[model samples]
Target: MGQANNKTVLLPLAFALGLAGLAFLPAVHGNPKTFAAFLGVSAALSAWDALLFVSTRRGGRTLSVDVALKKQHYLQACVQGSLMAYWGYYWPPVYAFAPFILAQLVFAYAFDMLLVWSRRDVYTLGFAPFPVVVSINLFLWFKPDWFYLQFLIVALGLAAKELIRWNRDGRRTHIFNPSSFPLAVVSVFLLAAGKSDITWGQSIATTQFYPPNMYLVLFLLGMPGQFLFGVTTMTMSAVVSTYVFGRLYFAATGIYFFYDSYIPISVFLGMHLLFNDPATSPRTELGRIIYGSLYGLSAVWLYQLLGSAGMPTFYDKLLQVPLLNLSAKWIDRVAGQWFTLGRSLTARQRNLAYMSIWAVIFAGMSATQGVGDSHPGQWLPFWRQACEDGRAYACPYLADLETSFCDRGSGWACNEAGLLHIALSRSGEDLRRADPAGAAVPLRRGCELGFATACQNLNTLTSGTGSFARAQPTIEDLPIILRGSKGEIRERDPSALYALACHEGWPDTCGRSPLTANSLP
Candidate 1:
């Protein structure tokens, strides 16, 4: 009886942990709406689990097939519908999340049909959908807008299925039991609250969503609960047997990679793309891009190495132990030896190595035409002309001096040129030659490339010169402008805030405003 209870519990716990991993993916992509949806679904699922518990306890008997099937279908449909509604509310234009909902429903129906055709029991039919849901949730995390809704639907389905099993059986006795339900509930609330805070544009310092301190608090708070739960769920005899089995499994097989390599790389790429640009300074951009690329490449390389080695075998799964410690230690030893060898090179050899490195660097720069030409803002025809002529380096100085530098490939030059055009429009120097439409191209590109200063400059030019009269600030642009203002204000500057206030139709400066003052803090 004790062993049977253990099996039932471990299954749900494993499913819940997998769902928690799915919940984190939205936060990874910085999608507040999706993150919120993930939280909501988690909460709803947890509530469903509670409902199942009450039902089973009250009945004092295993759940009937009719009760379980109805609950599962209802939960799946409700979750799918809620996610669709969220997507429609937050991201209607993209219409990206619609397909995921349809796919899930179709897959669920197909699984049901297959079960019927094979003459399997309803419980077996329900279990068949678990792996499919897990795989879909894993795939959906790579997309920013699609992740939250997909995860919520799939996770809710899994939770409902597990609850049904527990309802039919008195108590779980698996490696991943439902005893961790309390922790799962806590995670749901934390994730949901974090997402809600982000959506309302609340400050992170005040919000627990991504705060460093909150993570520490959660870690400490959950440790005791985990320990107590583990103790109560499994007996000492079972624990000993499992430990021995785990050791044997570790000896027989190696570690498995359940998570995908591309997910992390995609996440890094998305973050770097969002944060990279001129606003951060060229030095910061260089460091960020290099570091991001290196991390992505390293992850991919490790995945390839692991896949070639055939890790995470049946023995590892049966024992429930990771098997990669030995390989990791061996790799570390080899790396240390290689680093020591590198440090032992003679001065003459180092000099030759440095020369070769410089040659390669120069060749790469020549091939890519340096940062000036390749940067998004530097793609103007004039800047390209200058870069092609080998005079692109002078563009920034020329822009600062308000002179039309002939360097066509310089981002600084394009920015200056655009500003000049805006200034000319205001001064009535070139009404016939002024290209207000053309001016937005460089300004927007510069803004997107992390030039918060450039965004501030563009805000000034557009709002001041009447170019932005008909345009409304996009939801995406509001956060960028707000971030830019905070950066400017930190430097004891108020220009970005002033622009934002003016854009919002404030008569006075940002700091002096009655309505806007509250937004600053």
Candidate 2:
């Protein structure tokens, strides 16, 4: 390929990735359109790079060979990559795009190099694109129909890094975190234009909790970066602030404001990984404390704001970093001028003290069920009540939970989801989205799946009957632990038809736990 001594050979690796991507396509799990667009973009980029090099005689001989690499970039990339792999163990949607995500790494490299070299003579390449591309993929991705937009988001971020600048500590620095700037900007558009469905933002937020002990997984993955970079203060402060705020909120309202935890898994993820970028974040310890506090407090505020506005709250973490980045210099200047008590201690010592405090707090939080696998909010009873109470995210979450169960062939869940959908459609209070017709889909499926209640509900919905005419789903009972096959279970009480029924998914019979199987001892 370089027989003519071509300066830009159009990365062979890009073509290699296109071949690899077919393996992850629809048969296994990805949207085919998205992969096609990605592959096409890869081809176009290679063609353009080769054309530029051949014609202009100006394109650099090597892509980023002359650029100095930074430790934090690759370190952050590894951490983010490990996280996605672990989470993918419990979720296919996250894993289905392995090749596509890798393609972004190539895109970021060639496109970033192309953008730079097209403007100037010498281009310095490093691992700058690694963290940026990987981080964006970690949080949100586009639907296949709108897959091209994902490229736009990536382009905006990469370009903004080069175009947007401010003088910080005598060097021309980016005003906003490269990845975060595009996220916040795009979020504003999504919220304002009512187009959030184009991306998988909310699905990512919910599915993130699917992995067992995910909170701990994230904490462990985040520690190396914290240890190496001395960014513990920011993470620690953010955690403490959010934990305290959530505790106080629960104390006042008797409900967890963040829903499933004192701190939500995804938001906690943001605290650890997303907003703690040392380069764009506050440099001084005091400034970091304030910056982290604001991030935490603003997350709470933004969650409420977005929720109240009927927008997805996954944006809460994203919308703040850009704003915080804009303020970081001011914060450093102000806090540096104000706080001088730490002058006696070495920077390393202060960082150690911060890490020590954070470790203690994290331990306490884990020990106290503040950010772990088990929480009361995870139960159906809590969601059932919250849905009735019109908590902004509650009905949708409850509906999603039941719908997932329905998809798994649980007729009881289908019935439950149909009821919730009907209620949501009729109420018209929160999102004002009425999917009355969509309610029949689940009810009909439930009936076909052998849940009698769902059959009755389907009849009610299809027969043009009124709203919720049948029954509301009850979480007062959970499925009892039946320990045998249908035949063995029936053999326990050979005459008991109800035994057969319970084993066959009769909610009324299966609902009674063995502990309460009989009231009279």
Candidate 3:
């Protein structure tokens, strides 16, 4: 009866395994379309497994171990690891996936071995592995080569586990166990070697064995070396800092949230530094400044919240009154309104009165400040008037002209107008028919105002050269233009294609050949 039941369970298990094998097809290079077909097959297999599981439960029969193990959830993880390996082998040109496979394996082995040794039942292990595996997978996805070192580190971790198990009686046999220390040392060496190999290997070969000159160069050029160094340094610092900070916070405020907040803040800062692509556009300089200011303010606020405060003077409290009182009032009012109204606006009349007062105050301020006169070529007003006068086509005409509004005070308008002129020039239209050399002025102004695309465009017309002939594009600048072009083209922007084509030689530019071909019109 047990054997017969096992065979019945094997049906779903077999189906899930087959689906997993099929799913590998999409991950293969030059066969991404096969992935869709495999996805459908996987979905079907998942449904079959679900039905089997439900039927078994309803009939008061537990799924056999083999059957339960063959579920799509487990199969999916195995397939995902295999997919990473396939990508590591085939798509090495785009990204390295080897570390991902390694990381997944390490996580699985660690969780399984740990749980099993603890004598925890299989079901008792629950879905904890899922989130742990997923988080590690995402970390690998972001930094795949990080996995190579992690594999070696896992051995040290395993040793640590054994040592902890042996010492569980709270008695130390020796300060340094001979068996433990060597394994730890070897693990550290392997981890370091793996990191160095990733970062400096390619660059050394390219530059002919010269060590990186600048600290930043290691990170920008050396992927593995920089990654390993950064990971080790940050991890060590974070562990030590957390311990110290925790002790201090506990002693002072008895708060643990401050420690919890540390990781999030550190991660945020790291991401901003690592991932926030710096803008090449001149207009973006203003944005960068604003972002910097906001970041500074946030840092101050976070410190104020987390740091021990010296008692404030009476004057200090007076200065803080506006921010504190306004925040308290806003919070109270919002909570009251939300609870009282549920969905409907119970205080509609009061709300309208408050809104009208704010609107009148804004209007009075704008009129007193003479802001309207400062914006003479108001595109919205012109469009609205033209539409009221039954000119349905005027909007498109203005868009074509790239003259949505006239505001000499507005840098954005000048930049857009410049782009419009450049597009007209590209379309083989003679701007000389209307403004002669005046067309170049907007293009030049736009470039000076920090519009990088405009700068490249104006360089083509005025400098009698393209961006390629000027100098090698910076690493930061290339990705910005490429990514922007990608987004713009995806949104059906015709002009972005030309920008993309011009940056074809950029190292990070993906699908450049197709873009270059498409841009030739």
Best of the candidates, lDDT: 2
RMSD of each: 21.2, 7.0, 23.1
Q: Could you estimate the TM-score for every candidate?
A: 0.24, 0.77, 0.24
Which lDDT value does model 3 have at 391? 47
Deviation from truth (RMSD, Å), model 2 = 7.0
Candidate 2, residues 1-521, lDDT tens digits: the string is: 11223443444345435534643556323656665676677666667666666655553344323546778888888898898988787788777767667656666776776677566545666688888988888788877777767777787899999888988899998777788888888888988999999989888887788777888888788777876787888888888899999899877766788776788878898998889888899988889999999999999999999887767889999998988998999999899988876678876777677777787888899899898765666555567677777666678777876776677665667888888887788877425338777888889887887767888878787888754544433321123112110101213332243343354343455445444453101
lDDT (CA) per prediction: 0.33, 0.73, 0.33
Model 2: CA > 4 A from native: 1-32, 54-64, 383-409, 413-449, 453-521
Candidate that beats the other on TM-score, 1 or 3, i.e. the better one: 1
Best by TM-score: 2
Which whole-number lDDT from 0 to 100 does residue 380 have in model 2? Answer: 56
Rank order (by TM-score, best first): 2, 1, 3
lDDT of 2 at 25: 57
Which of the two, 2 or 3, has more TM-score?
2
lDDT of 3 by residue, 1-521 (tens): 12234334434445345544534632432244434433443454456556655665566564322113423235334433443333234234323433333333434443333323233212222332332243223222222223233333333433433453322124532222222232234323434454334322222112211121111222223223113222222222222343345445535543322222222222222222211112110112223223333333333344454233322111111122122212332333444433432135433443343334434533553453211122212223233244344443433333333332212222233444555455445544433324423446655665565546556666676665653112222222222223310111232343443345344422333444443443231
